[model samples]
Target: MNILFVHGNYPAQFVHLAKALAADGHRVVFLTGRKDPEVWPLTGVEVRRFELHREVSSEIHPYLIPMEQAVLQGQAVLRVLDVLAQEGFQPRLTFAHGGNGLSLFIRHLFPETRLIAYMEWWFRDETSHWCFPSYEFDQRLRTTMRNSIILQELEQCDVAVTPTSWQQQQFPKHYKDKIKVIFDGVDTSFFCPTPVKGELILNGLKCVQPLHIGENSLLLTYATRGMETLRGFPEFMRMLPPLLEALPNLEVVIAGDDRCVYSQAPDRADGSWKQALLEELGNRLDLGRVHFTGSLMYGEYQQMLNRSDLHVYFTRSYVTSWGLFQAAACGASLMVNRDPATNYVLKGDQAYWVDLDDPQHLVDCATKVLKSAPERRKNIKQSYLKSEWALGNCIASWVELINAQLKV
Candidate 1:
């Protein structure tokens, strides 16, 4: 089967799937706007890059900012499609990452091609309005217009894939029937618990605590794109002051780069609530205890997760982060907010549930995990292993799902 993968970045979610398909003797071609073309090179896969304009308005108006982004992305897609036609490369099936305007253009260019869109989010919920809250006053009007574009793309696709059931359920009733759930798998090899080398310098303190087989550590980790609002960074920061008072030795390490993740709009600049909370905690919380490692390479990220005793995974709405799965794969006891999406992946006694809006609850749950017995910690680790959230298993499942959809 000839497959063409379309995404702003080359091999983003399709890395493992692309390799598996190529290994199975299928031809694959990737169309991406990634600056580093050398990053993707599979034996049976060819990659092409298209220059994309990614500028956005720094204005206070939320609607204008996103509108600017959409326009730039749409223009980029049009250019890529023209190049593909001239090159005479027509793929039998096209896989696209939904939400990007590229998928809609693919449908327009190849009207007969069977396109399967990876539907990460539908932006249909009321909470979706909160994602761009600066436009809240005109949310109803904006949502209707934005969703119309998404629905049009959905109509063009032959099928769609959703990572989690929570995300799939968010689609319109008519489109839900065509959506299939296939989770983004973990790489268990890199994420599992390993021997610690030296004291990792967090904030300023040198934490050298060891996990004796089943014992938990005084460390807590939150990894994601560092947007203060979207990933609940502000709420996590607010809960930290009280949490530090309760557990002084407790260290919080936030991973990911701020520039790439956080919006730079003038309105969003004031979203530095995390820095403020850290300042208030001051030396009382151990200035060295709150560490931000910026963005880490994949290897370093997994190593940090391996060192964590407890991982705090919080999000405002339904979207799930890959960090949550990687932490679980590493056997880190997780404290997640009560959300339907996270509930599906972590169940029973494996995860502690907290209300995202309640800072006190987050503090209490962190304390519980820190004080839990080694035996209890061991049980949680076993639960993660038993659920087959391991990387190898996840990769295998992904291969099966994509292959099943192939027209072979």
Candidate 2:
């Protein structure tokens, strides 16, 4: 069987499942626009690349810019498909990400192939957006227009899959029947809590000497891909002043880049939200206790999680970060902002929840979690993810879905 995986980035959501399918004796080909294909270490799978042939027109309306870019990307994907078709490689099934316009033309080219879309998000009117101005005509117009490619994929694909129930809920009610909620599983084994072999060394990027984990020091970790509004960094930052002031021994390790990957840019002319917060909170923020390690490597990240006395993961009504699960896997006590309705990583008594409107509540929760007993801090070992969102189980689920789709 020939299986194809398509995404803008290489080995993203399909990282674990792609390798699993390849090991199952199926020929797996991953088509991506990732700049560096060799960065990923995939043994059995083949990686292919495509580049956009044309640039988006500057003359077009700003609202249509995304749609235009996606159309060009669809053209690029079609060209690659034509070459693959020439090589007599007709994929039995194609798993393509729905966000990018890459999957737009797959159904048109391969009529018989089962094109399953991995729909991460479905943009609608501004009401669907969390922080964006819902009443503004332009924001609402752009929001509705952003779903052009996604709606196309939803209309064309055999089945669409979302990682979380929240993500699935974002789509239109009429198309709800066609969507499936399948979590992109986590590798619990690597992320699990085991004693770090030696001293935890956070490789210093800004500082001269590497920061080693102190035995007596307490770590309150806030880990994310980017320190943006999407992951509730500002709220986390606001809590820090009061938190560090209250707990003298506690040190907050913020692990991520200071860039806007998901959310809109800051209103500040400098365009950095972190900087904006620093200016806003001026002397209130405790600079000494706050450690900003700009994007720790995977090993350092896991070690940070392991050393965390309490992990803080706060976000708006958006997709939950993978760090949330990693923190859980590492057995660190959680301080989540969102409710149980969206955040399935931690349940009742397993973690702490705080309100978005109440800044003091966030500080209060952090202070309490840090003050709690060490034994009481760690939670939810191999039970939850092991049964549900573990890598093996999710792979099995993908196989089951594929088998059902292909009918043996």
Off by over 4 Å in 1: 37-44, 53-72, 132-135, 193-217, 246-248, 259-273, 279-285, 373-380, 383-408
Candidate 2, clashing residue pairs?
Answer: none
**How does candidate 1 fare on TM-score?**
0.82
The deviation in Å at residue 132 for candidate 2 is 3.1
Q: Report the C-alpha lDDT of model 2 over 1-408, residue by residue, as the tens digit.
A: 999988889899989889988998999989898989898879899998889987998899988988998888888888888888889889999999886688888877788899899998776553346555233777778777888878888888898888877778878899888898888887887888766544567974554567776656777888777767767888888888887778888877888878887777777786788898898899987887788888777888888877778888887766777877777777766788765333666776667877867998888878887887355534434433435777778777888889889983
Candidate with maximal lDDT: 2
Q: Provide C-alpha RMSD values for all models, in order.
A: 4.7, 2.4
lDDT of 1 by residue, 255-314 (tens): 765532432222445545455555665665555556666666676667666666777887
Work out how many backbone clashes candidate 2 has. Answer: 0
Q: What's the lDDT for residue 224 in model 2? A: 74
Which residue pairs overlap in candidate 1's backbone? 186-391, 188-391, 203-288, 203-291, 204-288, 205-288, 256-294
Query: For model 1, what is the alpha-carbon lDDT of residue 107?
Result: 65
